[model samples]
Target chain A: MFEWNAYLIIIAAVAGLFFATAVAALVWAVKNGQFSNLEQGARSIFDAEEPEGIQQDFFPGEADEQRAKLEKERRPS
Target chain B: MSPLLSFFSSIDPKARPGIPVKVQLSEIDESMRTPSILFLSAAVCWLVIGSFFALVASIKLHSPDFLANVEWLTFGRARSAHLNAMAFGWANNAIFAVSLWIMARLCKTAVRHGGLLIIAGIFWNIGVTIGVIGILTGGLTSVEWLEMPPQVAPILAFSYILIGVWGVIAFRFRQLGHVYVSQWYILAALFWFPWLYIIAQTMIFIEPARGTVQAITNWWFAHNVLGLWFTPVGLGAIYYFLPKVLGRPIYSYYLSVLGFWSLALFYNWAGVHHLIGGPIPVWLISAGIVASVMMVIPVIVTAINHHFTAVGNARATWASPTLRFIVFGAMSYTLASLFGSGMALRDVNVVTHFTQFTVGHAHHGVYAFFTMVMYGSIYFMMPRMLNREWPSAALIKTHFWCCAIGIGIMLVGLHVGGWIQGMMMNELTPDGNPKYTFLEVVHALVPWLFSRSVSGVLLTIGHIAFFVHFFWMLAGPKISRYREGPTLLLDSIRGEGKAG
Candidate 1:
């Protein structure tokens, strides 16, 4: 029975260590300004830009036609 | 402007007006192409192999005499093979592919050692192969979830180290300033798995813990395999894909933080529930019960976050193969977790313990929740990796319906039948005799076992369809070319917007 209780102490120590590590990570994240811009964090994956000199249109297929229509709509005449 | 500079600019709050969305998502595709395909292909092969083993095991449960003469085909060996194949062979491989790609993309860094990843993946599969064969050949350890022979463990561990460290290295060189919630999950899972595996192996196999303590260690390791490893990776994929597909942010960032931290803290302690009604002390069981119940906070928080994000985009979600599987999985995660908490209660545990109810609950978590989410991630990742759309939307639809129906029938049959079996076992006649004989209980499960076999057959059909469809997409010259855009469920909806 004491052996089992000894195992419990190991469990407690591991649990305590895990809790400390988690708290430290959380503090580090907070201090590093990781949580400051939640909105920007969400949009970060979409930050990849279309390669330069390629069709600037984000939509696939009919890119040239779409560019022409945009240019015509923006003309001063 | 260069994509790298634009990436940094986009993260800066003040420079938003000048920031251009010029980063070709294809760059991510190019970087991850070779490794992702290699891992996914291996995972699909294992899915088919594992499904066959599962059908064999399910059949033996109801019909004991079938294939009994073959030494290698015994129920014990076959079942162990099936479990290891699915867990290590299919699930782990899929996780490596999907999570690594997600990590690279989110970090804005190309996977540096593509050739090394492929080599590690090949070794991982080889290790699983040798381990399964060892179990069949009478080298089995008989430990639940660790049945893979001792000889194979080192190889698996070494290969896993290679792959796991790759993810951290990618993160170390990440271009992004802010780490997303999904990255935190993936990173934690990568780190946690090796620690859990090594410690469990040391205590149970290496040092040999004292009698019941071996059982304690077993439960701890088994439960953490599901909770710490599979659960985190699945949730991380959900956190990434759901928002990406929906073109929106999660409902509440604060809730996500709470969900991640609470799960990390509570789940590790909850595995002792498996020891209930056994020789372990009452305090351990009580602690497990409390922690299991505490799981409600994270489960509900994740459920709400996923629900509110997808609720408004019902049409788009249904129309995308990726979102449909993911949403199904996200919902199953909520249901399975709630049921698991309920099962930990003594009153419920009394009836559910040592019954098919536990088996059904296991599938509900591992298959319906974890495997389905992995399937969704595969659908999302493959197209990007291969630069080609799925060959046939019909095959995708067929795969989904078959698995959904198969697991549904299996769960209902097992739970209802098992509950009755448990109740019957607990019944006592006058003078303290079991109301039913042992054979009678076994006899009663026959029909439920048969239903499980049928469900296995259906699942097998789904696996074959998925494998063939994937192969056709990969090898067929006509469909292998890079498609200009993604394949959506409905042609009418294609090119409409980025809603997919």
Candidate 2:
């Protein structure tokens, strides 16, 4: 049988309950949109691309000229 | 010229075949390049210097008389320099470069005025170089990681502020929907580091606190710097790469948040666990022990998420060097954190404290978890940044195996030696006379010392190979056209199957 000091046991129980609540709250946050689009947001502070992913911004910006340069770089005559 | 020649000459087809080749050249923000390059070059220099110190320290451990009389190359100084270089120069700079790239690419914006970042890199390197020299010249402050002389500390402080300001500005301009898990960690780490750094510097050095208060603050700062600053960036990179390489969404967003918040709340308090059983306050020790145990929640959640995400795609381990190193590092993070929590228990700490077990444990965290992930970042980066394939795949493999085995042997040896040392230290005669002397205990661990030397050599070999391969790739070579070179191991393997 566990030797339980009443006060100490009560403290331990309270602490455990607090931690469990905290854990539950964190899980909820992750399920919501907290973890999504992390990298995009970190860098988006610099440019005003369409709020969508990098793929979406390609058509509107300097994508055309960059595409030409890439095409030129790849052609091996 | 043959039509093939003409076709080759006109080879600017503008896109990677099959993959989206229409990458905007402007997307490769020129502003970010110089800062990244500066950080990388400085990191390489620090790696070399750190490795050299490691060689000396390992040799000293094996052969105490090897440099018995040399004041500069003593175990104390050499070990400090080695750790400083690895932390400040290698790991910190690598994180900075990757952070810059990730910020640029994710935001789809060039760094606004990257001049400050470059200056930060220069000042950071200068501070570290001076700090390392100061350590060798007997000017070390004798702090564990902050052994830098007073002269260099302020310089480093200034550099951190400058570098951190750029990140703050970048965070402000962040685009919506791009605010992913990795970005949160990066932003938090950037803010957390300077606050932690400045407060500790002020409390510990600028206005010296009372005797044990400094030690308390030191523990708080060191633990948080590792947990809050370095761990965040490494985890951020893993978050990015895991999804990118697996081509899958993370297993659960819920788990990611659970992992992050739990870490933020618990890890800062757990550093004092290192001082358990020492003369620290009883309440502080209790708090640290509780926090350490609570860390398991985050570790377990993160591990499950990573493992589930990585399931079925285990083949990527062999195919993509980046994934292999990063995923392995992610696994090590679990291992290190778990080991740390266990060691925090009073029973375990009794056996592991003041022994090689602690050393082994720290390496598992620093090298296996952090450095391995950095390697993955670099592997992913070099090809994209340089617009070329790695010069030789064989060298990459060699570097991987060497680092892996070196750390493995080092940890195993340390564990055994530490256990023996702990047990022997525990043994005392009935009359209060010790059964075995300290020297005797030292003699008992000689074999482990030799093993450590062997492991150090293996690690050195890996570092040297990595350094060479990186330089070679940076120095581009002329090659024939029409050879649509595959970038990743997975791609090459798939290509081989097609050819067959």
* TM match of model 1 to true structure: 0.88
Q: Which candidate has the top score in DockQ?
A: 1
- lDDT of each model, Cα atoms only? 0.81, 0.72
Chain B TM-score for candidate 1: 0.92
Clash count for candidate 2 is 31
| TM-score of chain B taken alone, every candidate | 0.92, 0.90
Once superposed on the true structure, which residue ranges of model 1 sit more than 4 Å away at CA?
Answer: A1-5, A48-77, B1-24, B478-484, B487-500
Give a tens-digit lDDT track for model 1, residues B1-500.
Answer: 99989855544434555533232455766777888888889999999999988988999999888888999979899999999999999999999998998898787666654788889999999999999999999899978999989888889999999888878976776777899989988988998899779878877787776767778888988998999999999999999888776555777876887799888777888889998999988888899999999999999999999999887566556656788788899999999999999999999999999999999999999999999999888887776666566767788888999999999889898988889889989989999999999889989989998999999998988899999998987885545333334432222133333212
- Model 2 regions more than 4 Å off: A1-77, B1-31, B430-433, B478-500
Candidate 2 per-residue lDDT, tens place, B1-500, comes to 79877644332323125433223323444456678778876777677778889889978876889887999989999998898888888988988888767665654444655776787888898898898899899998866778878678789888988887666665555444446667667866886777677767776788765556567677777877778888888888887767665445677756775677777656767778878888767887899899899999988998898888787655444456777788889999999989989999999999899998898888888888988998887877665555456767688888889999998999899888989988888888999887889999989988998898999989999988988887776676744111233233333343334323
Native contacts recovered, each model: 0.16, 0.06
TM-score of chain A of each: 0.56, 0.43
